[model samples]
Target: MREIRQIPSGSSLPDTQWQPPYYDAAPPPDPSQEDTWDVVRKIWRRKWLVMGITFGFIVAGAGTAMVMTPRYSAEVRVLIGLPDPNVANIEAVLRTILPNSETTQSEAYVISSREVARKVAYRLALDKSPEFNPALQPKEGWWHAVSPSRLLKELVALIAPKRNDSAAVPTADSAPMTEEQRLEEHIEAALLNRIEVTPLNRSHVLGISAESQEPVTAARIANTFADVYIEQQLMRKQRATDRANAWLQTRIGELQQTAHESDRAVEQYRRENGLYETKSDTVIAQQMGTLNADLVAAENAKADAQVRLAQATPRLNNPGDVDSLPSVLQSPLIATLRGQQAELERQAAELSSTYTSKHPKVRDIRAQIKDNTSKIKEEIERIVRGLRHEAKMADDRYTRITARMEQLKRQMGQSNDMTVKLRELEREAQANRTMLQTLMQRSKETVDQREIQTSNAEIISYATVPRNPSFPPVTLILVMATLVGAGTGILLALLLENLDRTFRTAEEVEEYTGLPSLALVPIVRGRSKAPGHVVKKPYSTFTGSLRMLNARLSLANENSAAPGGVMMFTSALPGEGKTRISSSFAQLMATEGQRVILLDLDWKRPNLHRMFNQPPGAGLADLLNGDITPEQAVYHDPASGAHVMFAGNVGRFPGYVAWIERLRMLLYTLSRHYDLIVLDTSPALLAPEVLHLARLVDRTVLVVKWASTPRRAVSSEIRNLYSVGGRIAGVVLSQVNPRRYRKYGYDDAGYLNPRHLVHTAG
Candidate 1:
């Protein structure tokens, strides 16, 4: 069985103080709360660059809008009527059958329809318009006085009504065949393309809109369409009435002749029979009354047939057919064929109004009519045969009656003694005939009333000339464009921000390394000759920040076990200003009246020789290897009054533990002479130089390059230093941007812009 040991808390037992082999790595920074504000801060941090890019897009969009041809639009309103209840059994008829939905659909279709659209095109006379004319030019404006092409682009941008540039395209003078006429032509076609027709949903109103180079013209086109459509409707109704009246008149004439003849035949039959014109002779008089009723009915049927034939014939021939036709004449196949033919005719009419004769539809209609004529003739012949057979049957019945009457007349003459009986028979027939005549007159009046009611369709409301224009809603269009532009701009900003990968702030350094930032050193130019020493002057921002950092570090551990301990300087990689920081810190300490020693522990690449203006010679390596003494290898930095040592003549791959042990011994020997030791070690992660040196150091300072050092490299370096017994003091973020640091929630008031600094220094 395994046993567990209970160790006292906070006690440094042999095993507890052994230190884990692995470095306690700081967990990764969470980038989850990155909100819109973060993106905005980033934009502000890179304001100039972002502004330049966004402006580029705006300019590009504006330029594109400029090159495009200017256009305008107009509109009109049309109201469609529902069926009138007063006409033709309206409720019942509607319940049984209804007009095609297209009756209303055409209102919307009219916007794209060749008929209405072409009329607008013709009215504007766009067919002869010139595409490009140098004579028509833009005039000088405020934008014109700016960079080249500004004026034209600005003019094009003035699509809003308040900013319209009417003078952009010049009008041609009538004297020289003014461009106005040509312009109108162009405007005409443009208006057709810009035209829109929309039927109000679930309503009878139609909105027609059109666009052109001129706003007023766009309005005019819309109004004209309304006027034309109304005029067309009125004309169609009048034509329909004329056709109805014509057929009614022809039918009335035929009925009048038939009625007159029937009256004469009745009069002759009464005279021949010698029947008294009284209501008593029921039998023979009733027979005459029956014949009159039959004649009236036949006349009425003929009249109705004539009216129907007239209505259907004219309608079928009228290529501008109504959307809704009478149900009696409706046939799906016929309607489809006619609709196709009507469309072809309509298209033809646009090119030439006289196209009715030579159009393909006209040819097809002629063929259809020829075929229908044969069928109609055959149907008429069959109906005529049936009528003839009925006429023959009536004739045969009359013959038989006449023969029986003749025999009765002869018998009556022979039996003159039965005169009372013949007289009584005559009286009865007369009485029945009088009642029949009264009934026939009433029937005739009723039929005439029905026919007149059926023939007429009342004009409910006359089409009025429209007072307001219907198109080119500039406010709506401009608003939509602006909103679209704004949304697109925001999306573009986010996409660009996500694509950016540059390190931009001091907080990022602290967050990456889990260390407090000591200082943000600006990248200085033309300072190649400056000594690798922290400027002791309190006036410099960099030096002041360093002093602040030192004070904060010391105060943080005032009651710690060790005070004024070793501080090591290292970085993730080379060229991150680590050596400069180390030298500067040592100089800063020495200037503060504290003895400081700056050691170059980067055995692979020693830089202290250059800083001290000394040659690379026998130093720490030779001294530690027993070739020389520590006192012989140490040198003084004359500029900052600090002691320095170059790690010299050392192999690139020295044993880490052996070197650290010897280095610790040398440090312990020098601790009595120097109050502080600043070791400038090579990049910890890149090489084991810093890790080996970390064991002898009391605290470590990692140098990071702002907007250059990757977070992964810094974190890895910090972990490596810690694993080797290096106590992380803090980080020194180099090459920081004041604006970016402030944006990342830091007070960058003490920092100066690098460019401004260089300018001031120069």
Candidate 2:
């Protein structure tokens, strides 16, 4: 081992000269605080994408609203009181049995029925209107049968083979309709669909609303629908009445003829057997009663004649009792003679005293008494002869009556059979009359009802012209579009962030690689052309960050395995700003008046010589080949006053173990000449010697490009170095964009912004 040459004080020393440096086991890795700013950063990074998506959605919404057809709506309210006009119900009387939810719905259904639609369509000529008739106009909306998307789907379905080999079952009646009837039906259905009938509050009232392209047409459709339904109901009632009248008239005629025939049969049967009726009795029984009464009257006449004959005999025999005899009392002349005889007798007796009756003379009274006696006798004889003749006539009449009565009794028995047949015929006539009467009454009542027939439902409110269209709410569409766009954009941003598996923050590097982040080296434009800018622009944030890195590396010597002067830069991959970082680091140290040298040991692709105005030849490779000493191979940058060694003539010599001794001698000689040695090694994963070189360095600074280096690669390489006894001082984040890095949720990243940094030359 060579003796230490100008090594800075307070630098870490190797435990042994022959052995590799002892890794300090980096002070427990940073906790890597997590906060809300990380999420904000991801969103901010994609804010443009979010806005673009949201704006696109808004435009689409506006376009859709413009393309949609406008519709006007009108409603006609109707009250459905009862189910049927022909029947009386509690609803019609008390009006308390209101229509239930189901009944109300049924009424609404009827109002919106296909039949009603047909009537309204006919009235409004909906088939001719383009709004309801597709045949009259081109179909609306984006999708039609011949549209590109639909054609594509049909093409695919036609070309694509079935997954199964079985043949498809043919659908029944799958024939396509290509007729005017189909178009007419389509128009009818379209008209029906435009109208909505809803029950209002579970009552009998229905709201028949219709939508159309024109407000007047919508109102007309609703009003006409209600009017047609009511008209149809009235027509039904009238037809029902007419049918009833016709049936009743036909039935009444048939019944009247049947009654006449039955009455004729009863009369014929009665006449055949002499069964005549008076009140409730037959004619044979009446004739029998009349014959019996005539016989009694004849006997009474005979008795009266016998009595008068006896009285006349008594009166003729005794003239003094002649006045008491019936014949004498009945004969006016005889009575007068008796009275004269009595007066004559009294005159004769009273002649001596006073002349009273017939006072002509006593002699004349005696003569008149004698004449009266003779006249009384003659009257009694006349009475006896008339009595005898009357008696004889009475006896003959009585005999004739008795004989007729006996004949009537015989006829009555025969008439009893006729009475039975007659009664049967009479009952049939009565039944026909009863049915005729009933039908006649019903027919009369129906005629009366027809005059006052009314509809079951009436229109309570007629539709009026609508003021506005009822579709394509533009404001609502826009708001929804905005929400959808924002949500999709946020999701897209999150997806991109997750897909980006690079380390974006110092916290990420520390947490992933288990190493302290020494510094965040901001990216410098055209750094390749001016690699010495760390010293060239000493006040720039780029140069300031390099100083910070240098300071941190120096301070880390306390916990590192090797001296602070021998610092090497590497990364998980090439082009991670390691070379630029190492060169700038060396220049910054040189500007501080310390002896600093940067060596490009990236055997595959070294870029350090570009930092200085020098040719690329005979540098690290020459040193590794033992062809030149370290002092001879070092290239100097005149602008930054620093020394740099580029990868020279890297012709791919022996790989891993070959350069160990030469590399050590070169570092050993360089250590004596320079106060700081900055080694830019190849990507850690790409070269096996990078790990070997890491073992020999005082401190290895793992350089990870910000938002560029993969976390897995960085962590794996850091673990590999620790496993192989290599000293990793810490990780350095290179090429950071302060504007973007600010969102990375770091406290110190704010100062890295260009706004806070200097850019003037030194």
Candidate 3:
């Protein structure tokens, strides 16, 4: 037994508030910024689960590929040829087409249409084939009852409301289709599903692909589509040509009738009017033309005569003036008279100048001049008379011509009405004859076209038998399954990791609780109750862990007022190895020549006495009540050289609230004697008394069973201790599984089971 010695008054610990070193604890790294190796390690920790899932997916993929049916595909390429436009500018709607993108797509649609599908189905007798027609196959077996599709359909039926849509819909003759028709339709639908029509590169060429169990049948089906489509096109063109010819023949007869009627009417009209097809104009028109020309000439003559008379009449009062008229002056007799009169005048002027006015020569010349003037007048008058006579003749001729023209106009008016009617009838007959000739020519062409019409679609390439199946791509499925499996496994591992909220490493404890993790104690499997691992293997990994814990506590107390401080071991919940850890620490301290007392203040569940292999005894309570001295009351452990104080008659242990001061006094008295005192208290959460006890101790070490204690409970207990002003030194990750701990990639437990070559003499 350790001897009790006097303790100085200053040996009592100073009242110091616990301040968690916030800066020492690093903030958790962002998950995105976490190291890649960290993620790898986390996944490696759950490798078994991941590998199992991956293997399951691989097997499923291989199984699915093996079970799937293989289908062979064959392609038939057909080029759609546009029909030649009609010479008559009348094109067949289906035959003449442009090869535009829309046209190509439309051709593809035609190749895949229900009509084409039906034709292909009938040609192949698909309705009688077991593959295309379900009705032709044997009845489904009992396995069909438990099929996923069947069960899902049954579930949907149960959940869905019953609808009466037949009453709201109309039916032809209120009758259902016959079974054969229904079967054919079903086969056609199935054929359509198996057939794929694609307008390759948006061109006029169409690729018709068909899938079947038999490679030969696939090729046959594809080829049959092209044949049926072309044949259908030919049949349509022939029908169209026949209809066109019939219509043309009927129109020709109608045109003949119209032409005959028109010709007869024109002839009858011509006979009634006594008309002939001599000229466009009539005899009255010719007569009128002659009269017009004569009338114009006569008018011109009469106008000239009147103009001459006008000029002569104005000057008739003076013969000399009349002689100045253009007509009179033009006459040869008037010209002669003017010349003689001028000569006579010249002779008279010469006589007058030579002799007296009464002279014989003057008298003679004057008389001659007078005689010539008289003759000129008479001539001028004659010319005037001629002009007047001519005017009269022109007037009479104009009047006769005008009278004749008036008669001709009357005749022309009467003939014009009959001519107009004749021309209209003749035009109608000519139009009917022209149209009949065109129709007769077109009818001949239409009748001939039916024999030589070409198909709009031409098969550019024939389909050949395929050599391989296209469905159930095994390699691709296996690869995808592997990828999906790995992804799912990693996802589930991460999900479970996130869900588990436990302290896994010292860093995790420090980061979560804002307290320094003092140590990592490897789990001593099956020896947790007593920590006997510290005895036989004194320098093993387990003892080394306890040494680390002891060193940290010693270092913490080095700066504290009391070097020999009281440390209480406690945890959030029971069964966290707190008692074991406290006992082990006390025994370790004693072995190192330190006077340590292991006190079992957990009256509710005392375990220190059992760890020392001792029975019931008076412990701290008896010592405090002055019932026994330290030597008599405390039992010394021989194995570890530590003093033990078990809870004596725990039923007599007083109320925690009233006994807190007593417990504090007892700890101080033990502190004076022992170099260290370890109080093994009950779980902080299980016993509220632990919180009161925590404040009396110099430092409180929280014992957390690694990966077993929940983080929230640790945080709650820490808060409780903090509220009571307990000095929490740090945390201990107790009972750590070394393998899993290393998997976390934390090297804090590197000293445990290290892989190294120790060169020591055997």
Number of the top lDDT candidate: 3
Mark the 10 consecutive residues where model 2 has the least summed lDDT: 88-97
Choose 1 or 3, whichever is better by TM-score: 3
How many clashing pairs does model 1 include? 28
Candidate 3, TM-score vs. the true structure? 0.75
Clashes of each: 28, 1, 1
RMSD of each: 35.1, 13.2, 9.1
Error of 2 at 650 (Å): 1.0
* Whole-model lDDT, model 2: 0.73
Report the Cα lDDT for residue 305, model 3: 85
What overall lDDT, based on C-alpha atoms, would model 3 receive against the true structure? 0.77
Over 4 Å off in model 1, which ranges? 1-17, 20-40, 74-108, 119-125, 131-192, 198-208, 214-227, 246-513, 522-529, 532-536, 559-563, 612-618, 622-629, 649-658, 747-762
Global lDDT of each model?
A: 0.57, 0.73, 0.77
Candidate 1 scores a C-alpha RMSD against the true structure in Å of 35.1
Q: Candidate 1 on 39-147: residue-level lDDT in tens?
A: 6765565565555655665565565455444555445666665442343332221111123457567645644454555565566554543322224445646744663
Cand. 2 TM to true fold: 0.63
Sort the predicted structures by lDDT, highest score first. Answer: 3, 2, 1
